[model samples]
Target: MSTLENDSLRSALASTPRPPRASAASAALTFGWRGMLKVRHVPEQLLDVTITPVMFLLMFTYLFGGAIEGSTGEYLDYVLPGILVMSVLFTTVYSGVALNTDLTKGVIDRFRSLPIAKPAPLLGALLGDTVRYLVAGIVIIVFGVILGYRPDAGVPGALAALAVTIVFAFGLSWVFTTLGLLLRSPSAVMNAGFMAIFPLTFLSNVFVDPSTLPAALEAFVEVNPISILATVSRGLMEGNAEAGDLAIVLATAVALTAIFAPLTVRLYRR
Candidate 1:
C-alpha cells in the first residue's frame, strides 16, 4: 500500500475508540442461565426455594397464629407479607456466599482471564438467585391461599407485589455480592450478612404491628427499609394501593441498586 494510505489507515484505527466494551448485563444473563442449568442437574436447592416457604407459612399460620393475632385467619393475613420478605432476605445472602466460594476456589480468577463481560459473574449470581426468590414467593403465596390468607387485591395487584419483592431482592443481591467480593471467607460473609439482615427484618413491622412495640422500636420500624417494603407488599396484596409506601419501596430498591451494582462491578473488575 502507498505510504499515505497506510498512514491514513493507522490514523483511523487510532482515532476510533475501541468498540464500547461489552457490559455486565450480557455476562449476568449468561451466568444466570448457567446457574439455572446447574439447578436442573442437582434439584436440591429447589427445595430451599420451593418447600421452605410452604413450611414457614404453615408453621406460622397454623401454629403461632392464634397466640399472636387472636385467630389463624387474622395472623395469616398479617404474616404473609412478612414471610415473603423473610424468604427474600434469606435467599439473597446466598449470592455473596456463592461469590465468596467461587473466589476461594479460584473460579473467579479463571473467570477474569476469559474475555467475558466484566460484570457477568456478579450479575449472573444476582439473576440466578432470583429464580429461587420467585420460587419462594410462589410457594408462600400458594400456601397462604390454602390457609385462608386470600389476597384482597386482584391478580394484577398480586403480580405487582411479587414484582416489588423480586426487584428488592435483586438490589439486595448486589449488596451481598459486593460483600462477598470484599470478604476473605464465605462463612464470615454468611454470618455477618445474616446478622445484619436479621435485625433489619425483625426490627421491622413484619410479624407484629409497629404501634404495639415500644416507642423507640416503633420509630425504627417507621424508617426501616424492610418495614417500608412490607408495607408496600401489604398494600398491593390487600389492594389498598398506598402510593407513598410503594414509592418508598421502589426508591429503596433503586438506591440500593445504584450503590451496590456499580460497587460490585468495580470490585469484580479489580
Candidate 2:
C-alpha cells in the first residue's frame, strides 16, 4: 500500500514482457501428446480393436469357411479385407466415446477456459487416434498372414489398404466427435455409435456374396458405403482396385469430415 512499494511493482511489471501466443500447430500437438498419454495410461481399451477384431476374424473364417467358400483358406482370402474395414470402423466409435467422457468429466470446460487454439484438443485427440487405427490394421494383417491369408497384391497392396482405411477412419471420426459433443452420456454415445455401425458392417458383403442375396438386398449391399469400402479394400489387397471404388471411399470420408467437423466445433462453443 506504500508509494515506494507501488513504484517498485510498476517498474518490475513494465520490465517484464507478455509471453507470445502459441501457434495453432504447436497447441494442437501439445494436446495431441496429451491424448497419446491417455492411451498409454489406459492401454486396456485397445482390446476393442485388437482382440475383438481377431476374434471376429477367427470365428467368421473357421465357422463359416467351409459352408461359404468350400475351404477355410479360400474364405480367409476373400474375407480379410472386409474384416479390416469393419474393424477400423468399429474403432472409430471410441472417438465419440472419449469426447463424451471428457465433456462429462469437465475436461472440455477446462480446455475452453485456456488460451490455446480452439480446435487443438479436438484435432489433437483425433490425431492421437490415428495411432490406434494403424496398430489395429497391423495386428489384423499380421494375424491374417499367420492364418494362411495372403494378399495377392502383397505388402504394398496391404499398405495401400491400410492407408485408405486410416484416411477414412479419420474422417468418419468427426461424425462421432459431433455425437460426443451433443450427447449427454459417454455410454449413450457408445451405444448409439454401434447402432449406426452394425448395419453398415454386417449387412455389407463382409461375410457373404451379395450375388447370393435377393435382388433388393443385393442392390442395397452393393451401394452401401461400408460395402464400397470393403470393395476398395479387397481390390487393393487383391491387386484389383477399381478407380471408381477408391474415389467413392475418398469422397465419402471427405464429405463426412466436411459436414461434421464444423458442427462439432459449433456444439462445443455453445
Query: Which candidate should be chosen as best, given lDDT against the real structure?
Result: 2
RMSD of each: 6.1, 1.8
Residue-level lDDT for 180 in candidate 1: 95
TM-score, structure 1 vs. true: 0.88
Give a tens-digit lDDT track for model 1, residues 42-123: 9986887788777888887889889988998999889998899888778998889989999999999999987777777777
Writing each residue's lDDT as its tens digit, candidate 2 over 201-249 gives 8899988889999999999999999898988899999999999999999
Could you tell me which 10 consecutive residues in candidate 2 have the lowest summed lDDT?
12-21
Q: What's the lDDT for candidate 2? A: 0.92
Worst 10 residues of 1 by lDDT: 15-24
TM-score of each: 0.88, 0.94
